[model samples]
Target: MKLSDLAESQILKAQAEGQFDKLKGAGKPLNLTADGGSAEAIGFRIMAEAGAVPREIDLQKAVQEQALVLKETEGEDARKRELKKLADLQMRLEMEREARRRFFGE
Candidate 1:
């Protein structure tokens, strides 16, 4: 059978018989072929391959974390400080989202 027809490129008997059990990175995903040809897209793909997460996502996570902290904060002074932090994070997240929407029209 052609390799493409193989189950993720593994024969069931070979897989179950532990033939590939000791191979490096077994059971892990392989990088499939990509179709992007533009330089910008290639740059983006390289950045993604290098584990770059977008600023918008980071800001969103920050907002969530700040909100959680605000929930657990005690005392009026501490609560006020936490609220301010949460507000700042939320503002940043909103700004990032707005920028993305303006640029991408999403």
Candidate 2:
């Protein structure tokens, strides 16, 4: 059978069994405005619901923290190390943005 046919049959069976009777928002109107039904928005919404963040976002945070560390470094050696680390994080963030732009055409 076709995928849609199978899906419809499953839904009908569940409805017959009253399996969806108590589902949350069962009779409520859908809130499609929240994500606008885009793949990126839907992915972000699901990630946020699961307490997760995108890799680029995490990398940006790391870059900020590294900057702070670089600023606080006292010795020349430590300063150089921290500056390198900060540069690396920033480069990684840029690469991530480029990759996403190429792959998702975002």
Candidate 3:
């Protein structure tokens, strides 16, 4: 038999055996962003959900957390510090995103 036919046969056998049932997000729509960029976004989203995000995505997450903290901060001095930290993290995240875009020609 041809290789493609063999593969299809195996897939059909697995399906009949219910080996693909009850998988995560089985009935849910994919959470893809509207950016319509490279498939890396989907990959990154999956990794992020598993707490294994890449450095750039991790930095972006940190920036978001810091922004929330800054909003809740009360003291002027503390808020200023949080703002500075948030700015630094945002800059780093932006740089990493640009580098990836250029490298992937996205």
Judge candidate 1 at residue 90 and give its lDDT: 86
TM-score of 2: 0.58
lDDT of each: 0.72, 0.82, 0.80
Better of 1 and 3 by lDDT: 3
What TM-score does each of the candidates earn?
Answer: 0.54, 0.58, 0.56
Lowest-sum lDDT 10-residue window in model 1 = 30-39
User: At residue 41, what lDDT does model 2 achieve?
Assistant: 72
Please identify which of the two predictions, 1 or 2, would achieve the higher TM-score against the true structure: 2
- Write the residue-wise lDDT of candidate 3 on 13-104 in tens digits: 97899865665566787755642654787767656665666889679779989999999999999999999999999999999989878866
Work out how many backbone clashes candidate 2 has.
0
Better of 2 and 3 by lDDT: 2
Off by over 4 Å in 1: 1-49
lDDT of 1: 0.72
Residue pairs of candidate 3 with colliding backbone atoms = none
Cα lDDT over the full model 3: 0.80
The Cα error of candidate 1 at residue 77, in Å, is 0.8
**Against the true structure, what is every candidate's RMSD?**
14.0, 7.6, 8.9
Estimate, for each residue in 67-90, the C-alpha lDDT of model 2 and write its tens digit.
Answer: 888888899999999999998999
